[model samples]
Target: MIEQSRLVTPVLGFAGFSGSGKTTLLEAVIPHLKSSGLRVGLMKHSHHDIEPDKPTKDSYRLRYAGSDQLLLATSKRHMLFFEYRDNEERDPQLRECLAQLDHSRLDIVLVEGFRNETLPKIEIHRPSYVKPTLFPHDPHIIAVAYDQKPDALDEFNLPSLDLNQPSDIAGFIKHWLANAPESEKYLAYELKL
Candidate 1:
């Protein structure tokens, strides 16, 4: 069989400072999105390193022994592990990683981090915090989700939604994906407009 190319998945993100409800909102919205028949893929960035295989495990031993890449498979599922030989190898290009997903099988890719990337994002703002709002500075930020309307809410005039209500956020995402102008500019592969 021929290898399949990655899908040109539409991408969006939840951008917020720490302690904001980005993750919690996503957890709630996912079920709502799935209920509507959307196939969603997610990528959450972790500040620390993650080790899925333990040192005692055979896969880990094999990886340390010599293998550059390993795949553990069973009828239920398969996991591919790649070893980066150099400690310097970190933070790979986000687009290259996104391209690895089968985007054709997904309606959206809900990314949790890489907030600085150029993809369109929905800013999560809690009015209690004094920090600068991301929407004022980031053109890629298309909307703001807030717990309570902030003093500067009228400045940008961008669309606003209640962060406490995941259903409303889900509705916005569904509609945004369906009607976003020149949507392909934010796909896994940039489209020729």
Candidate 2:
């Protein structure tokens, strides 16, 4: 999927079953990534309908009143709400979400779901979950980060990460970014000059 025409900026995914600590790892590593002078963008997928604006808020009322798209801009931040049409009830495509980001402003993009997509990802695993690992089935998985090394590791020869060390994971990510292939580094927008 990296070679696909839509690729814009380097993308790394954190994938695992629910309760595998994907969010926890990201929360811890994002600070390290930012501190190292990297601008990161994230695309997270949700199984449920999200109501970011409260029903009591004017924005929410306006959306329900027939506005298809609403942008709420404040001094500190801006939020956009897109009210999907009735016929558009479906999971968003990964490419569609990637296009929503301003690639020019981000050094890399971290995807939080879309585990079935063909992309390079770090598998977050917790042995206690008793869930089978994804790497054996997904060739796109480049490494495994775990709180405890799974017994299956003996059969797979992949890099193992200490889930407890966010700094180490950050370092690993930085290294991967530095060495990522040109095909995977396609940018959505390029400076002509």
Candidate 3:
């Protein structure tokens, strides 16, 4: 499935433990990417439940009343809400959500928080303050975006980037996206979640 996805759109992931600058980096990278004329699609999985609906909205009321899927469309745009009716539906597979993205109109799909998914990912590392690095375990991680270079970096020989410079990271992403398919051979190393 991942091989099939690569033929259509390049998918990259930003993964790190909480407070390791994953979100901080993307906020800057997205604008740089957009300014560079690339149409980017982003998918983020939140550990916390989010409330995008207000209590007074009809969509909220309908969902609250037991609607499974509610799509509110307007002249400008539309929002589709998929309410998970079962325990299995509550958390969806990353591949399923990736398919839903309009890849034909996108240059790349940036995924956040789907660490367990089999894809090329930049592992954001902050050694001085952050927890242990994940690259030692996850082979899906292609490179490191860090605040300080740790000793383990030599062991892995993975490309490293400074976390403080988002532009550099963005450039790294552009380069990685261009060559992501070449790294597919490492897919055999993917750890089963």
Candidate 4:
């Protein structure tokens, strides 16, 4: 049987400083998005190294035994691990990561930590943190989600979101998905120059 082609899906990102609650908001918003019949795929970028397979597990041992790539599969889910050379170890490109998702199963892709990438994103800001706001300089920031409105909020024309409410954020995402440009709705294979 021929493999099914991946669907073109919109990519939406959450961007913020480390403690600004990007993950927490996503944790809450995902279920809300899912409830509305969206199949969401997430791609995260991290500064630290990650080891999802335990040292004691066969998969980990096999990986250490020189497998360049490994897939751990079970009835419920699966995970793929790829080993990189020291020189090859660097922050992954957003387009490269986007290419990895099985898009046929997703309606949209939600991203975390690619704050600097040129993609449509919701800026999560906490006024109490006194951290610099990204919306001022990032044209890719389409909206701001905050616990309290920033003093500079009125200066911009962007929509503001209440960080404390996931349902409202989900509503905003649903609306965005509906209106996103066809160029932005497609996957990264088309993103490549």
- The best candidate by lDDT is 4
**TM-scores, each model vs. reference:** 0.85, 0.89, 0.85, 0.91
For 1-193, candidate 2 gives per-residue lDDT tens digits of: 2333555588889999998999989999999999999999988888987888789999889999999888898999888777778876678877767766677799999999899987789999999999989998998888899999987776788889999999999999999999878665543433221
Q: Tens digit of lDDT per residue, candidate 1, span 1-193?
A: 3334333667898898877778988999999999999999888876777789899999989999989889988899777776788878488567766765666678889988788888889898887876578887888888899988877768988889998889999999999988887553365343222
True-structure Cα RMSD, model 3: 4.9
Candidate lDDT scores, in order, read: 0.81, 0.85, 0.79, 0.86
Q: In candidate 4, which residue pairs get closer than 3 Å at backbone N, Cα or C atoms, i.e. clash?
A: none
Encode model 3's per-residue lDDT on 1-193: one tens digit a residue: 2333344567788888888888888998899898888998888888787779899999999998999889888999777788886756367677667666666688888888888778888998888765999889999888899988977988998999888888888888777766656555222222122
RMSD of each: 3.8, 3.9, 4.9, 3.3
Candidate 2: residue 37 lDDT (0-100): 99
Off by over 4 Å in 2: 1-7, 185-193
**Tens digits of per-residue lDDT for model 4 on 17-125?**
9999999999999999999989989988889998887899999999999898888899999998878866666778887777667777988899998999988899999
